[model samples]
Target: MTPIKDTHPSASSAVESGAPGARVGNFRWVICGLLFFATMINYMDRQIIGVLKPQLSHELGWTDTGYANIVSAFQLAYACGYLFGGRLMDRFGVRRGLSWAAFLWSVAAVAHGLVRTVLGFSIARLGLGLAEGGNFPAAIKTVTEWFPLKERALATGVFNSASNIGAIVCPLTVPLLAAKFGWPAAFYITGALGLGWIVAWALLYDSPETHPRLSVAERAYIEEGRVVTTEAAAPWLSLLRFRAAWAYMIAGLLAGPVWWFYLFWLPDFLQKRYHLTLQQTGVRVGIVYTMAIVGSIGGGWLAAKLIGRGWSLNAARKTSLLVCAVCVTPVFFAASVENSWVTVALVGLAAAAHQGWSANLYTFVSDTMPKRAVSSVVGLGGFVSGIASMGNAQVVGYVVTKTGSYALIFAWASTMYLLSLLAIQILVPKLVDARENERRVVTDDGTSV
Candidate 1:
């Protein structure tokens, strides 16, 4: 809990001197762009299976239970990978950690093209989940390193919106690829997309201080008011002591399953509820996820704007979260509505709200924790989310088999964000910076004693 001092003397001096009138540059935004694309590709790769589930089920004779098992394999592997991936990113740094993760997941994505049986697909999904787990940890850490505290939520929101973009891309392209080339081609094409990102990442990414393209003013600007940690990577288990960490974990436990349900089962829901064809499902699903893109950016922007206008960070973040939770409540009516587009609009609103909530939720880590602990804490939340997602897959499969309706699942999703918000409020009543606490005690005369 003790604050670690900034170890880089030059950076500290630069900050203290107000960067000496150095001209600011926009290089940090360039880094944010890369994160956006990486996330887009990550989700596209994962979503291909969901888009093709019906075709695969019919062609291969997969029961709902069987399909759930396949999804469960991925979630289970993701849970394991999130724990280790966060630590690895902390130990090895984002550049190398993200490169390896992209490479491994891409290979796994391509491997799906060669698999035909349920077992084969499950194995490929397991690999995909393990490798893909590193994406958010590395991306979140990069945002911490690149952006200032005030801008972190907006940056996180912008990059996080790529998830919806990826979701959008999957439906638009996956159906065409499956219809034209084969379902396997969908996997092959999306998997190859990550390699291109790897090259760009290797070429363009580095720490702000070390990055060749970064300006002195920008570096100083980013460093100002930031807690520069010089400590070794904190153990993942050690993070559990903080109430902030528990708040994040519980939020993920409640909200992660809802997102998972949308990602994996929405296509099935469309097909069952409205009797849409593959192409029709693709278009409608795209519409739903597109709304999420708007929510993600809007949510992040709202909080950032409020913070800029003199709102406390805690108030701004929590206020955005409350808005998102209210937006999600209308989805409770989605299952009862007779019109399909009406249903899409309702579900879309909920999905959008989820993204908005997620954008701020992610920013909470960098806002409250020290720089060194950001990736590890993010990894812990993801680990909890993955476990919850695994259980959700099983429950969804069971519910579908028993009742032959998505109403029960929709009801649960509708209320999760509000529930999560309450848990967050209870656990972390205020967002307190750990490093700020460490500086609280000074001499009576205000000089270091």
Candidate 2:
């Protein structure tokens, strides 16, 4: 992620040190690194459930429907939290809000070890969901604060890439940890990692305006060609009225289930489909996420290169998203294939395309919304996504229980991306920011920050 350049005289002067004209040096990279690690911790805690699902289900004597309901419980709470978490981030500012969120989820991750029954596990996962639901709202808000429009997609890509890291690490580590020490101990160790991150975040993170080492040139670059920093001061309710915001919301809702399906079910699916051992399942999931990391970064770079070539920001994003949309459609046919390696390749491509599409979609908010509303808008979208995911989880659970197969599930996963892309096209059709009067307005908004 590129640093934001100073725009105003105050911002410019703040970063200039010693010399008559000196750049503060870019610090956005530092912030991006912090966010990346935080995401790693977030996904690590979340992915443990998938990696341990077989063990957990068997140990707890739970059925597929029961496991699905447990997953649904997390999504249900996450949906509710997403509604409020973004607003909290906007009110409290990213540093404090994210730090608190990280701490909460960390505690919840540890709490997972305490649950022995399905009900107990469900409750613990719900807590984990509520706490983790804050992640994207806080991360995306920081991206808006630190990166310029030109590099926002790439910045988002870097921030999100950490999730792949988390996913990869969890499977590789969790299964082994569970084998050696038991599943509960794995939770304790992963939970502890987040505690260290909370301390690091408190020590390292500050807003762009307050960061000590931001370069004058960097700050200027960020503020240059900016559309909406001051809009953050506007009531977030103002953002609700914007049609463009709804476009993102609807797109998120349609697509959210597909991701949740992968996150919560992929390990179980792989295990059942191939009769793989837990360790093998972990490796497979790890490979998929590792590929996702590449996809996320590569996707962002591809779009930036297009923008650098004089493509409009909207054109670049749309083009990249469309590519991802097209690439993912092939996954639908993958389920019917007989070869295991071919199935892996097809699933990997679909997973990669999802990450690529995600990197661009997250940037879409920063591109269109004023900085102030970014988190809230993200939260709104998350809320809708969370709801769809909750319902989707339950439905999948029932389907899997009734059919004893995931063929239909994989088919849905493959096609959902294309459907979502179409929704985005029909709803948005263009990438321009909505008119100022049409944006969401915060009414009687009050916050700690």
Q: Tell me, by TM-score, which candidate is best.
A: 1
The estimated TM-scores of all candidates read 0.94, 0.92
Q: Which stretches of candidate 2 lie over 4 Å from their true place?
A: 1-24, 227-237, 434-449
| Per-model lDDT | 0.88, 0.80
> What pairs collide in candidate 1?
none
Best of the candidates, lDDT: 1
* lDDT of candidate model 2 versus the reference: 0.80
Model 2 residue 388 CA deviation (Å) reads 0.6
Looking at model 1, report the run of 10 residues with the lowest lDDT sum: 440-449
For candidate 2, write residues 197-227 as lDDT tens digits.
9888898888766567676667765665553
lDDT of 2 at 397: 88
